[model samples]
Target chain A: MRWLNTRTITPLLFMAPVLVFAIVFFFLPVGFSLYISFHKWDSLSPPEFYGFTNYVYLLSKDPQFYRTLVNTFVFAGGTIAIGIPLALVVAYSFSQSRFQTVWRSIYWLPMITNIVAVAFIWKFVLNDAYGMLNRGLALVGLPGPGWLTNPSLSMFSVIMVFVWMQLGHNMLLVSAGLQSIDDTYYEAARIDGAHSGNIFWDITLPLLKPTILFLLITNFITGISYFALMMVLTEGGPAGSTNVTSLYMYNMAFSDLRLGRASAAAYILFALIFIVTLIQLRLFRRGGVEAHN
Target chain B: MADAGGIVRSRTLGSRALTVLKYTLLTIGAIVMVAPFLDMFFGALRTVPERLARPPVYFPQTPQWDNFAQVFREMPMLQWGINSLITTLSVTVLQVTSSAMAGYALAKFEFFGRMTAFRFVLGAQMFPFFLFIIPMFFILRYFPLVGGNDIFGKGGMGLLNSYLAIILPFAVSWHGVFLMRQFMMAVPSELLDAARMDGAGEFRIFFTIVLPLVTPGLATLAIFVFVYQWNEVIWTMTVTRTAPNLQTVPVGIYLLRGAYVEEAKMSVQQAAIFLSILPVMIAFLFLQRFYVRGLTAGGVKG
Candidate 1:
């Protein structure tokens, strides 16, 4: 009877792959990474138990560590400062516009394209000499600043390209939120003699608060952790002006083979991200019902 | 907000100007979105002299369409393409199969530990790719009895430098499973019960009935996985470092960046980039509907 039932066995059989994958890939590797963080490991030799040294050095002793963290925040902050509002406006525009399929196709080109190709395109576009941007600037008799070469502007260039690349995806998210607001609400607002500007401010903007806040947290997290663009675009160049924590950790682990220190850095970044998510969640939970009012 | 939800409006003068302004902004935004790509396309067609000229060429004087052909001769484009195809296809098929199977199990079956498995999936998504990069490399390197490793997973390369390393970590997509579960939940239970009563095996019922019903979800998940895996750089680059033979197109282009970074080779580089983007672009052109659905659905979810 038990064999004929096939109740438990069939489900277990079907679920085997994902369960195994989760254990092996997700849980096991994370545990191993934590264990490796406490011990100095180069993979070429037996790991030496280093205890708190790796964590301490990253937290206190490393200047590049602190600098990279700041650069990361600047990159993340810059992205939200520039990207979120731009995406919101563009998305709002997209909702009002016709020929949506055509518009969406054009906008989402970068979203579908690889990061390598994106970096290469922008590298050509932003070149100081003989580049499209500088050449355009030259025709108008305006000064063309070094977008990538200048240490101060390197992070800016990185941020702009990221924003440019991500605009379509973020727009897709915001547009989803915009479309969620019912037509009756707009009709009701219009019937109350609300002008377009005031209706936008009072009704639409308020409804979009949750979506915008969600975007802010997600985009910030993405900006902080993402360094692939920097790797292919600038390689954290011009005196490490654009260096970020994950990129630094990447090189430390793979390039320099300082696996232990890198693991400690990864843990730190993870904790910081965790803390950020918690703070945002707590703040948003308090302000959750305020959007309705 | 006046335009919210397709409201009817009288043609007031201020609203007319507003419409014009909105159109202008939309046109400008469209141009901005498309210009970089057009620039790249034109860049790919330029002659060597045009590229090197002072102030450089905005448009190609003579479109060297063969520059696309030149991409293959310049690098292992064919090899990279094949590698890319192999890895991406494997990951896609594996992820879809695994996710669908697991999703069906969790959604349809009343197993004892179903909630626990479901919770594990929900929680596992929080683990970002960065946290796994280093440890995963080591894990694959030390995987017991793989790629000539000992039982203790020592004294050999394990799964490193092979397609397995590139494919195994991504064999199960948590989000895919979650999405598939959501789709599977929509199927009525009575139909499944009827099938069971009719002496149909569970496997047969799942394959014949459930899968056909969830084609839209499968299509959504497939396109997402394919494009993502096709363009995946970081993990692929990390594992395929010593094994350049296994490098995908993006990784191949990236690692050998020096060869194509110069102004003279810029056309070929741009051509190669365009070629790399073309396959997925065309596929997306046809399947944009599913992608839009997935994007909107994913956005609505946490």
Candidate 2:
């Protein structure tokens, strides 16, 4: 039998586990989530078919939902704007510096650590009264604001911590990008007596555009979906100032038993991410950036 | 004449100044990156009296190293560590084997539905984990014929409190498959054909020949999966909220926050957090090259 032949059967055999997992764990949950989003489910009773009410409630009535949406955007935007540039600069230095491996290993520690550990470490470091951060600020003759206690500063604190956690990761990507640029470009520029700043702005920046674009898109996507740090650190506290959409959704499903509503929230966030990614792809295409390396 | 060191090595006064400035900034950045870990290490050593002091001592006088031991004494840390190891190891092994097998198939085989299957793997990676949290929870909770549940999946909690719930969802990583496929595509087809001509069965050739060829790729993916599954909190915490016996290190420490109310207890919490991260930290330090490769692969592609 052709199906029983080694070539055909072997491939099928190899693919069996992944295929089964994709169906049961990946595809089924996605479809099930969509299905559940239309109903009111509390796990204690049979789900009631509520049609679009869950979506409607979130869109038209939920102020917390709106706040979370805004908070998520802010967190994502702030991290991309601040974190990417910081990573690029650090990576630029990293690519140029000696003792590269040591610096990289040190910086990479937080990236590999657990999110809970990272949150707690920073939570202690940013303590209002006795935090090392405040103690150091006092040393420098500067006042230390409550990093996690102040509503306005809580989201920013979480964002900074998130950025710190991600710095090494993005820096490495940027460093790779920087290293991949041909030395010939720099050689030619230097022969013409181009200033270091001119070379950086004119040649280095242009050559690194693809890598930067990649970082921007990926980091933004991660930032938008990220809530673990906030969950462990602030627990979306200080009057929900740090409550991003994912944290809000987590509470909704687990704490409030609003499965349908939470699913609706997740789908809405997914849609936003989907649309943004598409727009990013379109922009990249227009900018002549090839993503498939 | 300028050497081939490029413009970065220009020996101008400005470049020298820039070099000095770069080192200064990077040194500060590295300090920022590592200081908190040092703080954690030191914080874990503070005595209860020191912790309860009005100003809150930053460093320990005697360095209560026993607090790390106390973490095990007071809490079910050994259980948590064992659970973490079991779930993480299971997920890592399953993901690596499944991804390697599937990756080899897609890279080498020309099956009827290969393209479709490959496309599904690519598309699957884009779906965020949060999207599946709700439905997957129910799916595990109502999984039939397991965890005392009947065929209709209604009699009991199903796999909700079991290790299966933690391990099963992560069995097959889409990114791992994609990465392995990328690695496998570089392997020459002639090698496999020669093995076949040598009277080798496909499974034998695969296990002995193809798997060895992709060891580096497998290492990269293994470290990647190990770190991720070890640090995974959300899904595990959700399923194990009522089943503390199954909770991993991070989840156990987080869920046990109520036990750590006092400042002295906070030191224990910090120690626990430190210990929770130590294994992965040690692993990453030793295998950082593989870790970096895996991370950059995901970062650039994702």
Candidate 3:
């Protein structure tokens, strides 16, 4: 009867699909990507071994590669700096308010909506001539710059959209973090003569650090992966001001058919994300372990 | 006594001011979030001429209720909607199952190389989707199978542009597996131990106890996959083209207009765009409770 017990094999039975999927879909494709990176492969032509030429050229000679990297960082930084704080504030407000549920939903509305739909509406609203922003500016007697066309403002506009789209989800996460804090702490703080400012600064921020750190890291990863809006809104135009590394990788691979170069570029982007995630984990590990230790 | 009285009065005044200030700030934040959706709805309502009016109409003179009908007529929108539904649903089910199974294995099993496998999977999740799109595209186009194909994987595009193209490659999610594993690990071992004492099969124990307890985590993974697959445009666009047939809603709506709203029949494009996203928004609204629960659950541990 003990030998007949079926408990041990359940995990194997259930995990078979995932195990098969990872091997066939994930690891296989990843290996092919790496193998293709060392070869000059177009879509039609057979891949030719080029060794490390693609990597060397991309790293040492390509100005566009570096520009895209900078653009990716700039876009990610802008979105994080503004989006995280704004989300935190709004989430905190809603947490304190009686209408927390309603406010959280309202903020989350944008996050769930189709990005293409949002991008189209913005495209209509940001048109230099007949745009909503311009018309509003005209009413207010201020000059409206070309939001999506002007190179200087295009990336900025892209970042604004990114920030808007991301704020809601981050807010929800932060609010949950806020709610998780024991109510007794707030009571103790009040008894200690803490004002609103002191309560927020001392209690809320420290306790919500885990959520904040999670939000920041995820935001950074997703922010740098901002290709959907770029594809719909600017198409990385106005002299490529909005071209992030991801978008650049996509175009190089699909549009230019430079499979090897794109693979190298993709590897670079992956490396960048890896380093960033590592740094983040290192920074947050101390805080996390200390709290639990 | 006078000084204490002044301080009390000042506190009351300060609190009132703070209340007023808080309301004002919230209103501003709400406006920022709400205004864009309002504009999208209004854009859908306005006519082509009205949409391109010199000053840009914020409010439509007459609502183009028929625009939605026009959207149905203009493209295989019905088909696109179906495609999105089929793909998203299939992917969600597949992901939930795979992730759950893998998660269960990781939580309960003490297999060799288990930790290494977990770490490797975790590392793989950091690779952006764009990085894998091209290689994935090639593999899908050339996978060996049923039809007459040489061992070289070339005899009429293997899986490219088919439903299988989208589904098989993304059936399992590393993040989903990781998340579910965390959730499964948190469940008490006492339950499993009790089941073992009863001579219950592992499968039965998992099905009876662990599965029910981890509904919240499974629900989170479902919503995540649903939203991610629904909103995903980059890979979908790269793989699919020629609208009115193969396109998803996101890609379909993208093709509705050429350059201007007037070119595409103003009301039709607007309506098509609206309809394209209607299912997702409706789904979101209906499952708002689940979404919040899932998001909160995921975030707490994330």
- Local distance difference test values of all predictions, in order: 0.88, 0.90, 0.79
DockQ head-to-head 1 vs 3, winner:
3
Badly placed stretches (over 4 Å) of model 2 are A1-4, B1-11, B298-302
lDDT of 2 by residue, B12-114 (tens): 6678899999999999999999999999998999998998998888878999999999999988999999999999999999999999999999999989899
Model 2 RMSD vs true structure: 2.6
Please provide, for model 1 over A18-123, each residue's C-alpha lDDT reduced to its tens digit, 9 standing for 90 to 100.
8889889998989999999999999889999999999999999999999999999999999999999999888888888899899899889999999999999888
Considering the two chains of model 1, state its CAPRI-style docking category: medium
DockQ-based ranking, best first?
Answer: 2, 3, 1
Count of clashes in candidate 2 = 0
Model 1 chain B worst lDDT run, 10 consecutive residues = B4-13
lDDT of 2 by residue, A1-293 (tens): 65778777889999999989988898789999999999999989998999999999999999999999999999999999999999989999999999888999988888889888998899889999889999999999999999999999999999899899999989999998888899999999989978889999999998888888888888888888988888889999899999999999999999999999999999999999999988998877765666644
For the predicted complex of model 1, DockQ is 0.54
For model 3, residues A1-293, the per-residue Cα lDDT tens digits are 65333444555677789778777777787889999999999978889999999999999999999999999999999999999998888777777676666676678777887878878878877879866778789889999999988899999998888888888888788888888899999899977767677888999899888888888888898887768888788888789999888889888998899999899888878888888988887867865722111
Model 1: per-residue lDDT, tens digit, B1-302? 56733454543555787777777877787787778888899999999999888767678878999999999999899999999999999999999999899989989999889999898787677666889999999999999997889999997999999999999999998888988888889888899999999999989999999999999998998998999999999999999988999999999998888786577998998999998899899989999989987776645432
In model 2, the Cα lDDT at residue A110 comes to: 88
Best by DockQ: 2
Evaluated against the true structure, the overall lDDT of model 2 is 0.90
